[model samples]
Target: MLGSLLLLWAGLLLLYFLWKTRRPKNFPPGPQPFPIFGNLLQLNLKNPMKDFEKLSKRYGKVYSVYFGGKPVVLLHGLQSVKEALMTRGVEFGGRPQGLLVNDINENKGVIIVNYGPSWKEQRRFAMSTLRNFGLGKLSMEERILEETSHLNSYIDKSAGQCLDPQTLFHNALSNVICAIMFGSHYNYEDQSFQSLIRMITENTKIINGPWGMLYDTIPLIRSLPLPFQKIFENRDKVKAFFQAKVTEHKETRVPGKPRDMIDCYLNEIDKRGNDGSSFDDGFMMVFLMDLFVAGTDTSSTTLRVGLLQLMMHPDVQARCQQEIDTVLGERKQVCYEDRHRMPYVQAVIHEVQRYGSVVPLSVFHATTQDTQVLGYSIPKGTMIIPNLSSVLYEEGQWKFPHDFNPSNFLNKEGEFVKPEAFVPFSLGPRMCLGEALARMELFLFFVTLLRRFQFHWPQDGGEPDLTPHFGIIQGPRPYRLGVRLRGRQSG
Candidate 1:
């Protein structure tokens, strides 16, 4: 009886394997799959980029990998990514519903929604709202400068002492988003604001680990009695928090004058009169959540990496200081417009983003329909990931792709030259929605801090580790830095 049972199981497994091997006609060729698991067993769930890079070399720039039954097409190299994302941009603009993003966002937000008329309408509304709120205007610049001043004061209070810097940076960055979204910034120590930050950070961390992959593969585990269940509960808590904020914003809506993103959205809702145009409270809440998540982490991580890079390469730091001193003099506050004059400072900022390459693999995009990428047919619904880090680190694209070199952005005449492949904001229709806001914040905050103090490695330590700690967003390993007020003579 035991021999008979084993034979039956073996036959079933063989049948499954045969079925899985029958690839769709014209689907991109990739590694083979096994029974039940597909090609999932071959991927390094912890760090899938390495696997994807290796496969790209084998299968050319565009290749496919199966995550369980799902086929994900990895778009590598600059040309391929640009072609698919830019030339035929909107056709491949749909966002895939990952286990975490789906549960947390529920298809309401601008960032992780499907490419349909609904998404188009919501995105248009958001773009218009941001413009109306002075996102690229002088008024917005003043608000950012105010936040930068507060940040400088906090760092000055630290007074050259060893500090974590994460919380301080996060507070400043989150406040910028808060001011834009909620019509006001919170005290750095406010319990509610702190809780919001903690929840967002926790969700980001949890969703990038093994359990996240497990949930994606077998969603039923989310309901199973396990520690992973807490992740779901926390997700709900985050959504509820945002929902409450939405309700408050709606109840306290001010007509004739829109103060923040919520107010602006509510005003639009009033104007449109709830005609199912995707400009409702639910969309507003998700949009706010998107800003909170993308705005906070990417800017903070870049600033953290910027400080670390400066510490390691003091020469570059000194150059930046010289430019700041020359441009702004000893006592003037830095403004967003100042970036145009401070070429070296701008170059350093660009290089920090290039070297850090925080969002290594951009948020996953799905082809809205069957598409041809580099002569290979990618079926509709095939996952598309633009390996953004690959472009940032491409050998031919930068002077020193692997090293932290600000000169990569400088021309022979020492003017800051924008590289064609500098795509930290990504390219095409689904590019980061917060690009302008993030750029403004980074410039203002970084210039403010540099003008006030000099950042350096701890005196007791040797060179600090520049190796990036990979999470959903890549950042430097935890390291303390010494900050001292920049004296007039030093400037």
Candidate 2:
């Protein structure tokens, strides 16, 4: 009996391994899978960017990798990514289902929901509603500048001291998002506000770390409690926070006069009442949460990366400041319109984004129908990972693809020029809707802060580590910088 049982177990294992390794017809070629583990064993779950680059080199620009018997097509370089995300966007626009992140998001919200009529409707409503609340207009600039003032004040309190500006920057950006979503801002010292920022930041790390990868690949261990459970816990807490704000808005908001995004969405629910529209209180809560989280994380991480790059290359910082001074010419503050004249400053900001590649592997996309990229077949439901880092640093696309030079964005005449490969906000139907707002905020906040202060690496801090703490959103490793009022020069 014992011999018979052992033989049966061995036979099942072999069958499972064979089934997992078989490639679909016309599928892109990839490295051989290792039994049930797939390519997970070959990757550094905590930071797989380098591993991905290595795989691409070995398997060509377009190749496949399996995560627990599931094949994910990785698109590298400008040609392949453009073909998939732009040329055949609608065909490759659907979001993957049954992943850990999908589960945590409950498969709702504009950012993660599968492509369909409902998603299209929600996205249109969000874009229009945001515009009604001053998006891409001077009124939106005023809102960002208000937060800039608060950010400046906080830095003023710590001027000439070595400090980690991570939390400071996060708070400023979070407040900007709050003003848009909730019609209010929070003080830097508000504990509740701090908690929200903390939780969202933590979620970004956890969702892209080892546990997130494990949860995505393995089906057997999901039901058992694990560290990844923290993601769901944090999600619940954030939902509760949004729900409270919704309750407050319901009690106080006027029917016709919308105060912010929330109020506008509430009015939308009333207008679509019983019309079979997807607009409702619960959907609104997750939608608002999506806007807030998406708005805060990417922008804040970019600022952190910007600060680090500026400090590491003081020459770049000084040049940006010189341009800022020349353009503003004693003006109290900078505006979005001023960016058109400040070419060098604009180049630096764009270079910072390109160098950082914050959203390296952008949110995973899946093919909506049977399609092919670069002559390779991709079946419906195959996951697509557009390697933005490849395009950001690809050869032939930029003058200096591997360096952190603002000149990459400048022509011989020193005019600002954006390369087609600079799709940091991504491309196609599912592209980020907040691109305009984010660009405005980055310009306003970067210009204002550079004008007010000069930042440098701490003298005793030794060699600065430029390595990023990789996640879904890449963030600069924690480090301290010495700050002083601009033009002081003397130590």
Candidate 3:
């Protein structure tokens, strides 16, 4: 009886293997699959982009890879990414409902939702809300300048000592986001605010590890009463914090004038008056959470990477200082409009983003409908992942894809030249909603620090490790840097 059962199991396994090899005629070429698992076992999971780059070398710019049982078409190179994300934008606008994002936001927020009337309504409302809160106006500039001032003072208080700038930079970035979303800011010592920040950091760290992949493959694991429970508990903590803030905003809402995103959302809820569409309290809470997560981490990590780059390459740092000194001599604060005059500084910012490429694969994009790319048929509901790092570091597109070269963004005449492949904020309708705000913050914060202080490697040690600690976002390995006040003779 045992021998007979073993023979039957072997036959079933053979049949499954045979079925896995039979791909549709128009499907893109990829590694062959085995029984049950598909090609998922072959993927690195921890650092999938490295595997993705290797596959691109083998299977050309655009090809398909299977994650668990799902099909994901990976787009590489500048031309392919632009074609899929830009020219044929709407058809490929849906976001996938997977473990990492769905477990957190649950298809409600602007950043990770399917392309539909609901998504359209929420996105439109958000764009309008940001504009109402002085997104690109002098008022908005004042908010950023205020945050920069606070940040500079905090760094200056370090008294030219070496310290890890991560927490300080994170506080400044999170405050800017907080002011935009909540119409208020938290002091550095606020325990509740610090707890929220810790939650954000933990989520980013865990979601990029093996456990995240395990959850993605077998979501039922999240239901088990163990370590997975902590994920939900943490998520609830974040949601509850936002919910409380939303309730506060509702209580303080004025008749017509909106104060921040929460106020604008509350106003919309009042305006809609049981329209029963997308705008609701639940949506508002999720939207606020999305803004908190997306806006804070990416900007903070980029700035951290920028500071490390400056320490590593002091010549680049000196050039940026010279430009800031030349442009804003003795000015109390740097302004957004002054960015154009500081070409080298702008170039360095661009280089930092490109070199870091924080969101290496970007938030995963899915196909809303059946589509074809580069002569391969992408089925409806197929996952579309644009390898953002590939575009930023593509050999033909960048002068030194690996090095921190500001010239990559400069012309022969020494003016800053924006590269077409520079899509750090991504592309198409789903591009980062906080692009303008993030750019303004990075510019003001970076220039402010360079103008007042010089970032140098620690005097007691070897070199500060410049290697990145990749999470959902990539940032530099933790290291301390000396912050010496820049004197007039420096420039």
Candidate 4:
């Protein structure tokens, strides 16, 4: 009986392999797949971007690779990426489903939902909410300046000691997001607030990490509770926090005055009343979580990377400080417009984004209808990966694509000139919705922090490791630095 059962199981496994690896006619060329596993084993799961970048060199511009038996078309080089994302925006604007996506909000939010009317509504509402909340005006700048001051004060309290600024930076950014979404911000020492920040930051790291990608490629991994328990736990904690806030808003909402994004959404829901629009309480929770999480991780990580890059190149840091000193002398604070005056500083900031390429691979895009990228027919529902890392670091796009040089953004005359290759926020309609807001935060925070403090690798301690913890978003390995009030030096 045991022998017979084993034979039956082996035959079933054989059938599964035969069925799973079958490809459609005219599929783009790619590495051969193995039984059941597909091309996952070929990838360095911890650093998939490097593997993909390497693949692009051999496979030419448009190519396919199997991740867990599914074909993902990777558009390499700047031209192909632009042709797909920018030129054929609608054709390649849909979001594909995955374990992480479905498990959280069931693909309801702006980032994960399919390209359709629902996506259109949520995106429109989100942008409208930002506008109504003073996204680009002086009011928004005031809020950011307040949070920037909070970050500066925290560093001030450190008194030049060796301290990791990771959590501190996350806290300040979280406050800005909180104020925008929930109409309130938290103190850095608040225990509950700290917990929420960890939940958001850590899970994003895990989701972008190798294991996260692995689970994403294979849906079966989602059923195994033990491997990704912490991620799910964080998901639950964050949603619960959002839910609680929703409940509070529901109970305490005013009839006329809409205080924040949440209140605006809730009021919209009531007004819609039975129209069956996508404005339910559940949708509100997911949307807020989406905004909160997306808003927190990217900006904070950008700040962290910029700080590390500056520390490693003190000469560059000195030049930037000199520029800031010369440009905004005696102006206790900075606004977004100041970027125009400090060209070197602007170049360095842009370089940090290009070199880091935080979201190395953009959020997965899908073919809305039958599409062709570079003459390769991509069927409807095919997953599209416009490797922004490849575009940012593509050989011909930047003079020194491999190096972390600010000159990449500056020309012979030493003025800031943005290369067409610098699309860190990505492209097309589904591009990062918070692009402007994030740019504003990075500028204000970098200038504000540098103007007040000079950061350095500790004299008595070891040099900081520049190696990034590769994930969905690449960020510097956690390290401490010494900080003290800057002594103004002339250029």
1-491, model 2: which lDDT tens digit per residue?
A: 99999999989997888786788888999988877788889888778889988988988999999997899999999999999999999999999999887887777779899999779978999999878778878889999999999888888888888767788888888888899988888988898898888887788777777777788888788888999888889989999999999999999999989988989888988988898877887788779889988898899889999999999899999999999999999788888999999999999999999999999998899999999999999999999999999999998999999889999999999999999999899899988999988999999999999999999988888888888888788888888878998867635
> Which run of 10 residues does model 2 get worst, by summed lDDT?
482-491
lDDT of each: 0.82, 0.89, 0.83, 0.84
Candidate 4 per-residue C-alpha lDDT over 1-491 given as tens digits, one digit per residue, 9 for 90 to 100 = 99999999999987787676666667677887776667888987777777887787788788888877777889887899899998999999998776576676677878888999889999999998888778888888999999988888888777557677788888888899999888787999899998988777777767766667767776766778645668878888888988888889889999558888888998888888999788887778789888987898888888889888888899999999899889888877788889988889999999999998888888889999997888888899989988888889988889899999999999999989999999889899999999878988999999998888888877766766787777767788888867877773311
In lDDT terms, which candidate is top? Answer: 2
Per-residue lDDT of model 1, residues 1-491, tens digit only? 99999999999888876676667877777888766566888987766777877888898887777776677778887988899999879878988876667777778878888899878888888788778788889878888888887877777677757777788888888888878887677888899889989988877877787777777777656677865666667766777887887788767776868778777777888888957688776777777788788879999989898998898888998888888889998667777888899889999999999999999888889989878877778777777889999899888988888888888999999898999999999899999877898888888888888877888778776766776776668888888878878863221
Q: Which parts of model 4 are misplaced by more than 4 Å?
A: 1-12, 209-211, 488-491
Q: List the residue pairs that clash in candidate 1.
A: none
Question: lDDT ranking from best to worst?
Answer: 2, 4, 3, 1
- My TM-score estimates for the predictions, one after another, are 0.94, 0.98, 0.95, 0.94
In model 4, the Cα lDDT at residue 339 comes to 92
Clashes of each: 0, 0, 0, 2
TM-score of 4: 0.94
What's the lDDT for residue 79 in model 2? Answer: 93
Distance from true location, Cα of 400 in model 1, Å: 1.6
